[model samples]
Target: MKALAGDLGIETAVSFPGRLTTDELSSLLGTAWINLHFSVAEGWCLSVMEAAAAGVPTVAYEVPGISESVVPGTSGLLAKDGDIGDLTNRVTEILHSPQHWWASSRRVVESRGWDRVAEDWERYLTVVFSSA
Candidate 1:
């Protein structure tokens, strides 16, 4: 990737830091400019959601899982599935606009916190068992 970019006269340096520990992951989210989630399949992307929580925007494909966390054009930008060119464009779009960082972060509306989700689940189970 570096060689390709260099060949194209692009000066940006890209690094892929493989699997980080929990603390490292947290730190990365807090400090990174953006999260690019390219997973083809996901139930829902915890990383994407966490990025949102950390006020970092994401660039992802428009699939069921990623869609749950990334609100297209708000929290982040989305591209049609398998459209690498579109995804690249979206990334460039976000990086070029300075205010987009704040706007995307502020616009992210988390669906629910883990505590709330757990509470709702417990309440649902209690009601179902009580009726049974």
Candidate 2:
């Protein structure tokens, strides 16, 4: 990754914080303007949710699990998997426009929270248990 970044003339910072506590992770996420996720597949991306909670938008490929978290043009923009150009364009688009960037951040903040998730699960579980 470092070599690729250098070849592209992009500056890179490599940190090997092997493990981090939740608080440490939150603090790190809070400082980021955007999170870039390039995974081919994921069941659920806790990192993406964490980034959203920190009011940082994400840029990721439009894959199944990732798509659910990052709604294109809402929480973040999505590019076709393996399309580096599209991904680069999307990132540039968001970073170049403050209005778009803040709008996406606002959407993420307004859309989900731990309280909301718990309430949703509680409601669903209540129905399931009652039916049983």
Which candidate leads in lDDT? 1
Q: For candidate 1, which ten residues in a row score worst on lDDT?
A: 102-111
Superposed by TM-score, candidate 1 places the C-alpha of residue 20 at a distance from the truth, in angstroms, of 3.2
Give lDDT tens digits, candidate 1, residues 10-83: 74666567889988887877777888899887897878877877778899998888888788777789998999
Compose the digit string of candidate 2's lDDT tens values, residues 1-132. 667767777744644456899999988876777889999898778787777767678899989899888867777889989999999998997787745665566567565777778889999999999999
- TM-score to native of every candidate shown: 0.66, 0.74
Over 4 Å off, model 1: 1-12, 16-19, 106-111, 115-132
> Candidate 1: lDDT of 71?
81
lDDT of the candidates, in the order given: 0.80, 0.79
Error of 2 at 17 (Å): 2.4
What are the per-model numbers of colliding residue pairs? 0, 0
| lDDT of model 1 at position 86 | 97
